[model samples]
Target: MAGTVQNREAFLNQIAERLGRPRITKPVERPNWNFRPQDEVLKSATQDELLEVLKEQCKRIHTTIYTTDNSELSSVLNEVVTNYGGGPIVTWKDERFSHWGLDSLMKQEWPNQDIHVYEWDHTKGEENIAKAEQANVGITISEITLAESGTVVLFSDENKGRTVSFLPATYIALIPKSSIVPRMTQAAQKMREIHQNTGHVASCINFITGPSNSADIELNLVVGVHGPVKATYIVINDL
Candidate 1:
């Protein structure tokens, strides 16, 4: 986020010039809204309670959720992969996979059996997307999870390919119990915290809720419209 250049002034000045008005460069204070995202729904809920909220919301979003501890995560992951038809799999180049003992599962165990696991490498550039598109399952760890909306927040970077979540037939998000928050309000605060303390934050943030859902003229809910046909959230109870 720090290295990126946002052309805010130039973009705004062009619009002002077209409208025949002097550019207003100085920032103006905005009025606070009557309602806030953090207002009252389980704002003070404990982590266990928040997990319940997330579970209920996932039902509405039609996303499957699985709870497993660190020791059982590998087996659980294997189960999900098998359930989704034993993939040509892709995952982020995240060290957390090693921390949670999944590195060997993908890099060694799965590939040896011809499951074909691909990790997103920065040098691959756009080729990564091609791999993702052909993959049956794409896995990513949730950066900050919003329980209220059943959304997993992903911050894309060199190690994390954004399209890994978009093009794959199925998307898997590994959400640690510690990363689960009550709502989007807390997720925004977490983003601000990252911006204030670190320079490694990715320029883009994606808030994905369940699988891609669309509707026709009759307003019938059709899951898996344009994006991933299936989305699963594996919530680690103890990370």
Candidate 2:
């Protein structure tokens, strides 16, 4: 094992030497792009137009979109639970969730249901992961929404585990209208700002356009093979 490690290090050193420099250590600024965003495919759009485009794109990708207000959020989630039927639930432990009264709402509405709230405790991580995997529904907050591709971006931190978005049969995201961006480029810039403020980005940033699907086998489409089979985006206009 030591010899193999030495060989790998020697190979990497040789490659660095051939490049006439060592690996980058400082934060590098990106070079100017040749094309402009407006000149290219994407352009600045009105909020109404973006929402329309996002809705259409989401439908095309087999994602459900529901527009609601803060007062209706509990009902929205309750409706989802009713439609989804009985099963375990996993949700993010975000303060915003409580601020929005989602935690109390869930408890009030789903008193008998098994609801697992994600926390940063490493001791319970394994158990939480298992619960998330077995859960029928997983709900979390969306950091940003890309209107161009109808994608919801999630930065996975301790409060929001990666499995909560991927390991369930159905995933519901609470997306604030203000979080919607014109495209992925803007979303990336927002993520960079987050990294700058936090001193580091989340371990995984997921871009989920729709439910997990593939048409690999003889062009026959399949869903939920690798992740949630169904996804719903609840766009809170008031938030």
Candidate 3:
């Protein structure tokens, strides 16, 4: 037993030595855009008109909107759980998420209903995958996404587990409006900055647009084959 343990330790040390330490990269310069502009215009006569447009879009897309005073993150999450038909809601093991009152919401909203809240730290790899596979909806707070093309970028990290966002049936992302950029190039620049600051780059960086969809067979569009069937973004302007 002692010999076996020594062998195992030696193997682990060899692997660690081979892996070495993570080295940080220098930040890359931002790219320039030279694209032609399209002539798309929206003429809204009143606030009611603009709201009507937003409502129509939301309804057409089968999405729900919950606005809170930034202080009411818990209330917003609670309302989402209640209205969206209770199911497994997956989040990361981040303090901000907990501080925003996800734990309380989980306790209150789950037991009474058939819903479950699964939190993963990514270190629990196989366990996280199991939870993600069984989950109905995955909730994540993104670093940024582009509004024009409706693109969400996820840098692989412990808190923002990639499987939680990709394996679930529905994905609900909470993004602060301030994080929104005008173009994808800007998003790439931001990512490069993050990579420079951190020594290790994410194992995977996923860019999601709309939901998992394909129009491969007979030109018939199919959804949910690759990932979530539905994707919703809750943009919090305040936070």
Per-model lDDT? 0.89, 0.81, 0.67
Residue 155 lDDT in candidate 3:
68
Q: Highest TM-score, which number?
A: 1
TM-score of candidate 3 against the unseen true structure: 0.68
lDDT of 1 by residue, 1-239 (tens): 23766997788889999999998767998888998755676778999989999999999998999999988999999998999998899899999999898977888889887899989998978889899989999999898998889999999988898988988899899999999998888888788888889854677899999999999999998877778988899998763
In model 3, how large is the Cα lDDT of residue 183? Answer: 46
lDDT for residue 75 in candidate 1, whole number 0-100:
93
Across residues 113-162, which tens digit of lDDT does each residue of candidate 3 receive? 76778888667778898899988888877677654455667766767788
Best by lDDT: 1
Reference-based lDDT, residue 149, model 2: 93
Model 2, position 191, has a per-residue lDDT of: 86
Model 2, span 1-239: residue lDDT tens: 22434587678778889999996546899799886754344565767778888899998899989998888888887787668775578887778877777767666557655544443344686887888878888888888999889999998877678888899889899998888888887887888898899888888889988899888859999998989999898998853
Query: Among all windows of ten consecutive residues in candidate 2, which has the lowest summed lDDT?
Result: 113-122
Error of 1 at 68 (Å): 1.2
- Model 3 lDDT at residue 95: 70
What residue runs in model 2 are displaced by over 4 Å at the alpha carbon?
1-12, 18-29, 38-42, 112-122
RMSD (Cα, Å) of candidate 1? 2.8
Backbone clashes (count) for model 2: 0
Q: What lDDT is obtained when candidate 3 is compared to the true structure?
A: 0.67
